[model samples]
Target: MNTYFITGIGTDVGKTVVAAIVTEAMQADYWKPVQAGELQHTDTHSVEELISNSKSVMHEHSYALRTPMSPHAAAAIDGVHIDLEMIEEPETENHLVIEGAGGLLVPLNEQETILDLIKNNYKVIVVSRHYLGSINHTLLTLSELRSRGLEVSGIIFNGKAHPTTEHIIKKMGHVEEIGRIDEEAVIDKQVIKKYAEMFKPRLEAL
Candidate 1:
């Protein structure tokens, strides 16, 4: 089973939403290693609620901090430390969807960032939402993944379309454009399922 690690150029780039689509598309198990805050309503919960597939299982997080901040700061406030070695991946015979917090360079601890959580075997999917200066952010993200020798399966654009922005990023990054999640009035299970079906073909191709 292949693992898909969903990351983003920066925070609030709709990583969780894109993750839900991929999870539903592949009927894959879902896991978010470290949750900084909103313990009652975490990324794991969001995906679970959004997906309609019975095959998908929600895995527990490695660490759940009390504060809503970067993992390192949240860990410090909670009097804990994030050991990358201790952040183990859950076993699954089917594909697994792993979602990261914030961006690639966000710190999980002083010595490590979210980038460290990604294993070499996992196929990376970068989620990008258009915004001013997003071009630079997206390019840098792709560059870092390439430099690390990680397998970047492709990208999933989220929200309203920006032709020029998407065009430039696609041209420069040279990554697969897996699919896009158009602006949704309400992203319910139906919406997620619709995107799931649309993305399934490309995801399987990967």
Candidate 2:
């Protein structure tokens, strides 16, 4: 079975959109360890609904904190502790995609960060935007992953407005230029597939 952990440089960077696309492509099961700020039309629900394959199972946090803050702060506001034990692992499946709450350093509890919850057995995918300072944030994130001895698949640049010269400068490992998302608010399946194919090698390498 193949397992993947999806994280981003920051919030609203299309991690969930890319996660949904991968689930749809591989017909894999999906799990969101912690979900904060869930509204009527949420990314988690949208992903669960869009992926039509009956084989995929979507699992979310038992306590859906209402605040649009970090998981630790949100849980504290609700008088609850963010417990990793509460996060259930998916049943034996061919592929499992675990989506992080926010970025890599987002606190899950007082001591544990999102990276702590991630299983080393899974390949990590960092999702970031093509805006300014992205290169720095992406590199920092990659460094952290390397420090943790985690395997990074590659990066997915979401919501790219215009091409930048950093694309050439940031070429490190087997990097792929995943297509951009024009509309930041909506999730486009085609864009997901375009990027998903770029992630194919890393996914297959696992």
Candidate 3:
């Protein structure tokens, strides 16, 4: 059972969407360890709704905060501390899809960042969405992962295809282009299933 840790260059880069695709593709269990806000419509709930696979199980978050902010701030507001050691991964026999918040450097606590939550065994998938200055963000993300000696499986581009941006990212980062999620009008279960099928081959290869 492979564990895919889905991260992004920055916030709103579609990590949850890509995580859904990968989870559906692999029929994997889903987990979001530290959700900062939106307790009503959490990432775990969103992925559960998006995926059509019966094999995928939605795991409870390790830390569910009330405020919509970084985990550290949210935890503080709630009068608690996020201990990385206490943030345990759910025990799952199936392939697990772990969606991260914001970006790699986002603080989970005063001492630890989001990067600290990713275990060495998990295959990292950096979700890169094209925007101005995205190239630098993408490269820096990959560089940090490399420097930490984390195993980066590849990148999943999320948004309209930008050949030049994609070209540069692939060439410079030297990471596999696993697959991409094109701009979708409505990302329903059917749409998620479509992208699941499209990404299955490459995901299986990983």
Query: For each predicted model, how many residue pairs clash, with residues at least 3 apart or on different chains?
Result: 0, 0, 0
State residue 97's C-alpha deviation in candidate 3, in Å.
0.6
Model 1 bad stretches (over 4 Å): none
Tens-digit lDDT string for candidate 2 (1-206): 78878898888787888888778767788877677786565666877866666788776555588888998999899899987787777675479888887789999788988988777788677787766777777778887888898877666666645455346525753355433445545546655555556655555655
- TM-score (all chains, Cα) for each model: 0.98, 0.84, 0.98
Tell me which of candidates 1 and 2 scores higher on TM-score: 1
Give the CA lDDT, 0 to 100, for residue 121 in model 1: 91
Give the per-residue lDDT of model 1 (tens digit) for 28-81.
999999998999898889999999989999999999998999999999999999
lDDT of 3 by residue, 1-206 (tens): 89999999999999999999999999999999999889999988889899987888999989999999998999999999999888889998899999999999999889999999888998899999999999999999999998999978999999999999999999999999988889989989999999899989988888
Q: How many Å off is the CA of 1 in candidate 1?
A: 1.3
- In candidate 3, what residue range of length 10 has the lowest lDDT sum? 84-93
Model 1 lowest lDDT segment of ten: 85-94
Off by over 4 Å in 3: none
Global CA lDDT computed for model 2: 0.73
